[model samples]
Target: MNKKTLLFTALLVFGILQSGYTPPEEGMFPLSELHKLDLKKAGLKIDQKEIYNPNGTSLVDALVNVGGCTGSFISNEGLIITNHHCAFSAVQLASTPENDYLNKGLVAKSKEEEIEAKGLTCRITDSYEDVSNRVLGAVAQITDPSSRLQLINNTMKNIVNEAEQKDPTIKAEVSEMFIGKTYVLFRYKTILDVRLVYVPNRQIGEFGGETDNWVWPRHTGDFSFMRAYVSKDGKPTKYSKDNVPYTPKKFLKVNANGTDEEDFVFILGYPGRTFRHRPSEFITYQQKFVLPYTSELYDFQNQTMENAGKKDKRIEIKLATRIKRNANVMKNYRGKLQGLRGIDLIGQKKQEDAALAEFINNNVAEKAKYGNLMKDIDELYKVINGDANRDLWLSQIYNSTSLLAVSRNINNFKTALDAQPAAQKQGFFDQNINQVKQALSNSYSSFELDVDKTILKRMLNDAAAFSPQQKVNAVNKITSKGSNSAALIDQFIKHTFELSKLKNQDYVLNILLKNPKSISAYQDALLQLEQDLNKQIAALKPEKDRREGLLNKLMGDYVNVKEKFLKKDFIPDANSTLRLTYGYVRGYWPADATYMKPYTTIKGIIEKGATGNPDFGYPETIKTLWNAKDFGPFAKKDLNDVPVSFLYNMDTTGGNSGSPIMNANGELIGVNFDRAYGATINDYAWNESYSRSIGVDIRYVLWVATKIDKADFLIKEIGIKL
Candidate 1:
């Protein structure tokens, strides 16, 4: 036998160290398998059927994917509850200097008072079916790696297309589970006419700001309310004043009694990606290169926006959503990196690989078919990661400035003009000219040349410092006009923005409308820069594509064989699919000998009050209530205080924000918003000992609505008997 055969045989021989598995599997499992999980043993007081049922109305009927986060119907009239941050973009969009809803809270006194939330949609899963066998069977005959992937994708596309043909209003998608070893088809009922109902001030919703995000013992309310409207016939429709409130078949009852420590809890939401089963080589590359670089880039972008906003107030509102998104990812990447180091994830992955090799030894068929999977995957990582730095640098350049993006778009427009036949060129130009004009108009709305120039210089410096010598020479050639590095960069920035007609939307639109035959009419310095970067990327493309294809194939094979032979129940990594994860309301120690409680109270808010900063500036309305000790019916008698926020040990990630946290009786208890910093790595590895998800207590949400905001009609609409 050859060397590869010897390694395979060795792993097969050591596969079986033990027969059984450990308790508490660490993934978001499919909702169809609720009966298989021992929920009762973990303190659940209700039957599994109450939580999920395919043929009847159940809790799933109440759940919704709001925007990208999770939410649920809390009232029969389509009252939806999600995280306040999830609704922040809508709040910012609807606000103005005179009616700044973001600073003061938003509440609609009557149905007619509610304003439309443009570009917002809510999706609910109508049904899901396992189609794994059909998918795998169709692709079984293809041996070539790329061909197999193409065939699988084509098959899934056909299935979705056929499903959508039957009902134009419904959306269908095929999601993979177990790393393509299993597949599920989900059908969704989409509601388009969503409206803003209520949102707290920035002081209450984003109480901790960036400083206290992803930390436990939190006091942020972090909750918001919205309503879904449909046509009079109860069908999905666009934003029309004639639309009526949508009455869902099922909605959750808000339980103001709240939860105690160790009580049963579960979350239903659309979770984003998690790579717990990724190989060690990939993890090492991320820890060393990707996370660190991206974190710093995020910081540069945020600072540029902040500095620019100080000079222009209009830019602040226009860029608020972008800033919030960048900040969230910035902090999240930093937390993930720290958590990776804290837990030694790379080392742990190496250990798991050894055990997996041993497990493979027990199955002779798997040994023969999948013996070289991990070895091949690890080898491909070295080849793929070789050009990662160049690719990342180019990505940063393209995204860092609006002018560069516009230049690239204009270049593409010119290319399109050349590619079309003379007879059809006019038609094509007429079709695409307005799109370019619209893009230019939108880009200039938030454009700040100073901010863009600052970011451009930073990216140029970093790219020059990190790129290979050949690429560095190309950059040097571009900057050779000026005497020093700073002077050269400033010269480049000034030349690009000054000579470009693209800065004025009307000028670009007029030029495009006239249909210039050459790049001379619209050419700018950024176009030259784009041309240079494109050449560098093209030179590196062949090897990158080859290595990436091989790695993808190897991973698919490994997952397939592992699923067939592994003794434990296989749960797939999350792919922004609807999933259910159950756990208990609990807390833990951040370090040795320091136990943290699961829940926080109004007392913590009082202690954090009136720091004069927006994050901790407690509103006077709530302050008076606290000073008078006017604990409403929403306060918990057992704790003798009103609950603010609580923690639980459930598995979740980014898209899980605003998911409804429910108790055993299928009642809404709170809203899942953040996770403890220690738990950020739960996306990679769930450490039951330390990982925890944080949520705002539901009673606090009720208190704010009924007392602070005095939204009594809205409260009555939700049937909350306060």
Candidate 2:
């Protein structure tokens, strides 16, 4: 389908889904409501703030932004807990066939036994300090966007320099929210002494297979344990025999008795990102086009990986973790899209925009000041839409790797007759050589020809349909053949003797071989593209300037309308730090025909098991454990051999995995893992009626640690009371 047609169809789908839903009478709650609620009224202790001191810990204490995941310190001595999935990359990189840590989990018996991950360090620098006044003050005086940004950056950097000088270990980072209207300075103490502790087996940790990912009634025990190490002097230090487990000043005690319905709970961790403040048009775009397209891409990848997984055990092992991770993300985006549709998010946004327009009309006399903001924003949206296909084209070309295609491209690069301008030469070098090298590094390790063919077919088709000027270079045709392409790539790489010669091939060939020297070449190419693409985009920006201005005005209007009509206050979705949300533990029905009750028990494991797929298969040990039927009085009849999991109204996103789900009394009851926006996109704008946080019951974690793994010593270290 054409770009416009695809966008329209997506919007139509969103409209149809949203048509039937009614907005909540109370709307969503604002941050103000959090303070008004009585702690006792929500079954929470007033002393929660005293027990779990969020402010006491510096940004360096509880907040960590790693390469792929966020982490927090749990103990004074640096005991850390994060999602198992987050730790998967480190584990995979460190493991070999003889010692596959992913298949069989790992646990360090003592501080000395802990393994230090390479190229992985947890940094917590003192980077944050309030710079809201400085930013807002500058913006108040400046009208030009470029000047405003420069002023804000300069002010923020000055603040950071001052803060960092106070503490050498401190690092400051500025976070922009509401498109730079609000800024938060994050200060952290860099902690580079992180080490692996304990992790659960893949079977128990990732139960119910791909089918249950991002869905309610989840049984995945997605938790991992790690301890922070420091020098003998009790300061953060790198890996060394002299290092010891850093004792935390405070570590949460594991509460064996879990929480019930309507209990007040809170999660303290680094939540990645949320788009709650995005303009309505942008939200509409996501609901209609972006999410579905992403979901399609993920689905393709999953299928390709799964098919290849079956032939080679190694492939299965390598791809299994990635598939599950991507599946959850895909499910999340799909659910968010659906949620956006169901709640008529765009309609609500439009209503809010109208209200804001009225407010501006009544309060502001200068039409020139606010009138064109909405128009400009609309124009910006249109301009962005024109270039949206660029990403799709790029994705297709980057995701494929066929050996023959690479060989042909390499040969072409070697023999290209044209010596273009310096700028053009650099552009080709960056686009063709550098990117391919990076792709090859990651893709070569897990190469599968059949998988490449499937991805290539989709990408090639997409590229072929691209606007003539926007199409990717033509190496795709050569690699379109499955095994035939692989043979060709083999011959090309073998015949090419010198690295210098290989680097000079035409764009297509340079990309295939995964050349090492392409990095420098890519730098040159990138500079060329940046200048060209920027100039092209800059030209279109002015055409839609009027519309873009309108959209911004509309955004303000929507916010005002939401405040007037929607009773529930809308707070910015969680961004790590500490957040408290209260709601009853309840099950949800995702579709009319299916009800996902809140929990998955051990029996479900046996029922879902298949010998062919290890992901779906329950290990013999777990199966035997289930047959034993060692149930205490806690097992309910409704659960009937099924496991009982709880659902809560807590707001969470990607980085919240392994977050401690604590009761009002500050007792740990569950581990926050995933969200249930599998079929809907409600997370983008939480519709309390639907979006719910899914977590593994804390009781299960204790059971697994004490019963399953028999790590009584480690459990005792965490102060688990049975």
Q: Which candidate is the best by lDDT?
A: 1
| Index of the highest-TM-score prediction | 1
lDDT tens readout by residue for model 2, 609-692: 744655676558767766776543334454545243568766667766666677766656677777775424534666555677
For candidate 1, lDDT tens digit of each residue in 581-630? 88878768789877778888887887777465556777787778977777
Q: Candidates' TM-scores?
A: 0.90, 0.75
> Which pairs in model 1 have colliding backbones?
12-361, 15-358
In terms of lDDT, model 2 sits at: 0.58
Q: How big is the positional error of residue 714 in model 2, measured in Å on the Cα after superposition?
A: 1.4
lDDT of each: 0.79, 0.58
